[model samples]
Target: MVETGTGTLPTYTETLPRIPESARTARRLVDLALTVWDMNEVRDAAEMVVSELLANAVHHARCESVRLTVTRLSDSRVQVSVVDRSRAHPRRRAAGSMEESGRGLGIVNALAHGRWGVDSLAWGKRVWADLEVTSGE
Candidate 1:
């Protein structure tokens, strides 16, 4: 993991293969970062957000691997991001009742409270979600 930040805010980053199993590792990274920062209040949400982000990359991106970054934005907020070599941005689509897929972004949207978006990079794109830690965390 690479740790970098300005003063108190810390960011943790890891590069993982673009495979389904990588989502588990991504979630673990999220859990560890939030736990160490004493931001357990948002750990679960962060984990889910990371999982969905990584899943999107694994299923859609043609890259061999993806970079996951969990950054502490503030005392009560954290941002989870996945960078992949796919320029195709994500789109929100309505899923049928029997559909098993197409709900990942929706889940991320709800978990992040609509605080998620994609950043287009020169080589690819970055999908990120911001989770706000509740009070008393």
Candidate 2:
């Protein structure tokens, strides 16, 4: 069963491994989307953010685990965060020539309903985004 805080559901308090090819992949994220709250649009956005963040973590930092957090915030929005032991923070670069990447954060920022960022504390950094939940519940 998922836990809740007042109106928030699930809270996204999961710590999965950060292996390159861990089974806790897209399907697992989608499963969480369905089980966490209830909104098709929100699910898709959250799943995309999670997948991108997870992929970035593995591809760039080579992390072996991430802390996933999903919390329903005020003003009808869902905040998604994936914390990893990144060597450093994410860098925002323009679309370079023949570049096949460097647009994940921009996508997250565009889709989310509110402010989002990738920051680190004493331990490491966390990549998070927020979106308006349209579950209609």
Candidate 3:
């Protein structure tokens, strides 16, 4: 496979607040992956992370609305980025007694094979990270 950096091209987008509606956007990321990742495992990983991040934003970030984007990068890596009109960063809490939530980023960090972080953007803030993917085509 040839390694080419084509900047950042979003594969999908969604609103975190509206989980179901936002899910439709996540499907587009799968379509983008078809051209790169032919395997279901690799593509699903990216899509799942995209959903988790966006959902997290809606659950945590106090934003009117959130935007989710996924971009394919070089070195067989794909970035799942979420932007929200929020100042609070992504946080992980220790799982307490029958806690129903938490562990989103941790799951993402564990599944992904690269770096992830939260940063301040011009408008609000963007939580983005890279997931190293395998290509067999």
On TM-score, the leading prediction is: 1
lDDT of every model, 2 decimals = 0.92, 0.68, 0.66
Evaluation by lDDT, superior candidate among 1 and 2:
1
Clashes of each: 0, 3, 0
- Candidate 3: the clashing residue pairs are none
**Candidate 1 lDDT, 16-106, residue by residue in tens:** 9999999999999889898889999998888888988999999999989999999999889999999999999999889999998899999
Model 1, poorest ten-residue lDDT window?
1-10
Residue 46 displacement in candidate 1 (angstroms): 0.7
- Tell me the lDDT of model 3 at 132: 72
Error of 2 at 48 (Å): 1.0
Per-residue C-alpha lDDT of model 2 across residues 56-106, encoded as one tens digit per residue: 777776556777767766446777777877658876667777889888777
lDDT score for candidate 1 against the true structure: 0.92
Worst 10 residues of 2 by lDDT: 1-10
Can you rank all candidates by lDDT, best first?
1, 2, 3
Q: Over the stretch 32-93, how does candidate 3's per-residue lDDT look in tens digits?
A: 65455443445666677776777777676665677766666654776777898777777866
Question: Positional deviation of 53 in candidate 3, in angstroms?
Answer: 0.6
